[model samples]
Target: MAEFNSNCSTTSDQDDSIDIQQLMEDIDFDNVYSMEQEINEYETDQFNIMYNTDDDDDDDDDNGTIEKSVTLKPIEEQIKSEKLNPLSTTIVNTKKPMTLKYIQDEIEKIPDYLMKRNKVFKQLIYETLTTMSISTSTNNMEDLRKIAISIYKIMVIQTYQLLWAAYLKSGMRQLIIPSKTQRAYSTMLPIWPKEIKLLLQADKHVNENETYFNFINAQLHELDDQLKQNQMKLNIKANHFQGYTLSIQNIIETYIEQHLHCLRMEIEHKIELIQYDYHIQILKLEYLRHKPNTFQKQLMKELCHSKYEQETTEQEVNLLKQQITYYTSTNQSFECLPIAHNSLIDSIQNSQIRQQLFLQYKDVAKQSRAKIFALYMKTAKEQRDEYKNKHEINLKKMWDAYNSTSDNDKISSTMLDLMHQRCMKISEYIKCIYKFKSQSFVSNSKS
Candidate 1:
């Protein structure tokens, strides 16, 4: 048991030693602590100027020159004044040797107020990096250095933005680049190293790129606004077109309807006139078909003349004498009655003969009256039946004409309605085509 316990203790110690080595290899605590200490020192202390060299302008030995000394109090005061008013700071000419310490000192010569601001900014950067570092598996030195440099570059860009704002607010037309040859009291020294120069060049390039991007964005926005305006105008135009089309269609339909109504009324009037003309022709044709012949008319006239002569002989004689005289004056001969007719007239004038003739005439009249009554009754019945049949036929003809006219009217009305429907459909199709064309045009314009 003692040997096993000893072996376990030895293994635990070896494991602890291995873990310590791994931890030491993974994280260089010394380097991190040292960097933090340098940052703190830089934050707290003011920059130191170690050496100053100026060319002497005195006449002495050819190889020898006098040293012009600078008072420390005045240098401190000047440096303080320069830190307070960076824009008014002037470049100082010196022959100072370039060194790492010298460069670092120059960079750390920021104003106290700016240094205070840097502390807060640095803390924020550290906090942000701490959060980002938690997600990563390992902290490679090179990767950490790159991340720090990138953060610093972003910070520098932000500082440049602030400086740019100040420059704009100052309303200065141009920025004068500092040079050794063009020294001025208001100008800064052109003593920055190659790295700072390169950084400044990069910032300038970034600013130019941003300016170009902004210009392009503004142009694109203008184009977009123009397109929207065009779309709105198109919409308004379409609306106006649609309204005009509808108004015109309404006008056309109203005119057509009015014209159709007038045409219908005219057709009805023409039909009535045609029916009246047809009825008049039918009456004229019936009168011609039933008209008396010339032979019958002559017989009726002779009977009436004979009845008149029997009723009044003296009036007949006087009328014949006038006719004879008129014929003689006209050089035309008159034909007298026959001998048998004269004997009959003399027999009628004798009383005895007239009495006998009267008895015979009475007998003949009674028999004839009976015969005439039978003929009159038969003719009257036949005429009444014929008249009834004619009336029925006329009524049937009139009913057939009315039905035919009504059917024609119905067919014409149906045809007119169909034409109207077709017209409406055509108009709707035209409207749809117009709409489709408008929509397609709009789509094409958009594309």
Candidate 2:
């Protein structure tokens, strides 16, 4: 990294004032107005110098005046000049109308200060540039020269720019405080310059005790007058308040008395109401206490009945247990199917008897199924009759709604909606009928 010395060293106290004063004088009004023009001209000149092919050397023209052309010195000489004084490059006067001779004279003194103050910075930049110029990455001498020239130009321009900024800031400071000593302006800090040395430099703090004591004394007197006026106003207000106190007290007492009377009446009424409610509650409690307890008798009866049932269940359980013990003692096996009697089951198990019993069961089942079918048909007919009645009611309602509306469009839309609802109900009824038929078929197959 190429680090430029941004800390522009201050000159002697005498030269400092002269430089600041000279700079203030040299800052022409025209220069402020034509600042853009100056920048543009400087850029054009630099561009011309970079690519100008008319480098016919410095020659005398017909007017006997020497014409200056673009020229570059050898790198060794340039390095030597830099070592001697880096800012030795001719300062181009960007402004044409404003003469910069005074500026030049003032600037000429800066080199010594910079040299003495920034010796380390100079050595760093020199070493960096030297390393870069000699690096193997560079293609040729021309590139190295260009790089060195650009770096030097940048360093000088940045240094001057910083100095100019500091100058302007100090000038403005002096303008604001003309009593500021030249030594103060000279040692004033700059807007630029990021070096550690600049931070370490002590700044002179300007004592602000410039006749402010008189101003403070004047302000104190004004405040005392204001305090006195406020005291007078307060005394007048107190006198006025004292005059109003008796009437205000009477008004407050009357208002309090009125509100107290109203509160007393309201409290009496509330107390009466509360007492009446309390009496009513007492009567209700007495009545409830005297009322018949039939519900309690019923609960007792239910409890007694549950107890009897429980006792009977226990006795029955005991009897079953006794029977189970008797069977266990006889070594009889437990049957999964409940049969009324073993003898009856045995009788049915005989093949001829079993066939006869099966035929009898079939005949009974057929009779029961016929009765169930007849009942289902009767219920279905009743349901169909109810559906027809409901459909007629819905149609009557639709017609009523249609007649109630005078708008033809509303009638038509209402009719369409009603028809759609009717269609949906019909489809649902059909589906139910289909389900019933399917159930009948299933039952027949099962039989």
Candidate 3:
């Protein structure tokens, strides 16, 4: 019979048991051919055994062998072939990166002083521009542009300081790292090249020949002229309205006066009827009735004579005339009062007059408002000029302070630069922001 004994690397460890754990650990794709070879060899033995003594073979000799070399060279090669270039790795971003100024350009070599000066000026201009541009409308933004023109003299002086700082720093042999305070001034740093360009452009954009005050006055002239013309127009309107009101008031007064005169005359005539006319009629009737012979009796008869009828007739006639005059005058007064007041009220209520008055009032108000605005602009410009002058003076005062700290001026030197840069960048940002704000406002308004 054929011998069925099989040699295996890990098949002798257990009683008729093959450990799968050892197979998996020991086998890999690199050695799959070795495993197939072992399987074929086992099958060959099985076939031979079956032909020779298959019925006599015991279950104890039925163990299978597995050979896996665990060679991973092929897999390793595949992995190598699929590898990606390090530089080609995809980068994910949530938000776009903000633009930072090209600070490196300021320094051609390490420890370039221009870099520091650049930072300082950047800070100064940034602050100044921001101050100017924030919330400015197109109408108001012009002020910033004009104001930028006024900044030249100040700019020149600061430039001198930078040159001076450059000279001062030339004597230092130490590698400079600015202080914390100086670092704070970095916030005011301007992109010097960009700022200088913007400023020069803005400065030159305004005609070099135009005077500063002239620009200010030009802004004022149109507004002032309109105001003066409006004032004159308002003055005329006010005078006209005043005369109208007075005329109406006088007409009303005359009507009332005439009414009162009529009432007085009527009362006087009634009294005259009761007193003078009544007395005259009474005397005439007494004279007609008294004819007694004895003087004393005739006087008694005269005193007793009844003239009531005649007196009543005269009184009634005079009363009737007074009533007629009173009624006529009263009717005239009532008619005149209504006509006069209605005409006056009509004029008052008329839209033409009201509108004219309203327009005139607005004209007056507008004149004043415009004048105020003009004055405000003038004052603001003047104040700015004054402030700039004061700043120049302060700069001069700080010269000694600037000099006194020359040995340790990494801070002040940085401050001057930083402040200047803050001024410039702030100025430019202000201009941009103002322009954007104006465009947005106008767009919104149109919408």
Candidate 4:
């Protein structure tokens, strides 16, 4: 047997595999606005400076060899930002020598998710990988490298969440992205580098064990406060740690603490296409227990079942209406109903599908559910039995009472109208059951 690959991520976001959602978001999140914002700000500042400046010249045109002056402080600050990057300490993202204006464009198209709401979630996941590292960790370079790689996965997901939250807040949800752009639209979930980071960089090495735990707690406290203030309305899920064994290192811990986390969240399932907003705590346990494979299976089942019920019920109702017409055309002079009418209802009621329906209903209780299914099952047994039994009994009773003078065609026509009435009632029954079930589900949720 071929060995199965165990490297599949719970989310396509994790593995940089085929995350269609990420692909779609890539166009949106791709920082496309940095240059515009910067240009506008700079122009405004330039106008203000030019207006306020004093010029003393005996001859305005003749005395001037006019030159534009660039400020050293702002440029120096920008240079420092480019020099020492927090993301990559080794060499920085100097693939192209970018000015502040260039970086501004990156920020505009998409706000850096790594810089926003997702930071906390990334930290939590990173903490888990850190905890796991203790068990699988090696003192050697290779294991340290693997642990760093795992941390990158956590960071990538955090970036996705951050950018998504920023988009929601931007109120650009309905700006119809042109179809051509949408085809290239994918979410941006970039992996942090696999390089091992030194948590302590050029800080005085304090060999105090007590200081380490306290420092982590202090950083967590600060982050918690920021999240509570700025992120009162987001749900953030993270892999939970059992016991108090996990601890964060210095600067990495401090950097994460400064970024705010959102406690209120509007959660959406891509496959289920269902959405609801809830406090993060309410879904925290559920998120921790998330099994992607099982969720996909459950979503498939729900969609299939809903479609099957709708199609089959429509077919059955149409079949009954057609049967009313079929029986109407049978010989009128005989003044007799056909044996086929009773046989049809009886065969359908006893069929495998009907048995399955009964079994499906049998499992439901009237406690919290009050399922519409029970109503359907109860009605099927009663109405179907009535139709079959009456067809059998009335055929014999009417045959004995009637003479050849009776217009059997007219009588059958009356029966067809009656069947039409029953069909209407069945349609009403199906709708009412669905309405009742919806109300019950709402009530149950509130309770």
Query: Candidate 1 at 42: error in angstroms?
Result: 99
Q: Cα deviation in Å at residue 383, candidate 2? A: 1.4
Off by over 4 Å in 4: 1-156, 159-170, 179-373, 376-447
> lDDT, candidate 2, residue 67?
28
Residue-level lDDT tens digits of model 1 in 12-120: 2122122222211222112111212221222111011011111122112211211221111111222223221111112222322122234234324442312324554
Screening candidate 2 with a backbone cut-off below 3 angstroms (N, C-alpha, C), the clashing residue pairs are none
Model 4 residue 276 distance off true place after TM-score fit, in angstroms? 13
Q: What lDDT score is found at residue 34 in candidate 2?
A: 21
**How accurate locally, in lDDT, is each candidate?**
0.29, 0.30, 0.28, 0.27
* Residue-level lDDT tens digits of model 2 in 127-153: 444544533333332232232232332
In terms of lDDT, which candidate is strongest?
Answer: 2
Clashes of each: 0, 0, 33, 27
Kindly provide the TM-score of model 1 when superposed on the true structure, using C-alpha atoms.
Answer: 0.14
The lDDT of model 4 is 0.27
Measured against the true structure, the TM-scores of the candidates, in listed sequence, are: 0.14, 0.19, 0.21, 0.15
By summed lDDT, the worst window of 10 consecutive residues in model 2 runs over 1-10
Off-target runs (Cα >4 Å) in candidate 1 are 1-354, 365-381, 400-447
Candidate 3: residue 4 Cα off by (Å): 99
Off by over 4 Å in 2: 1-352, 405-418, 425-447
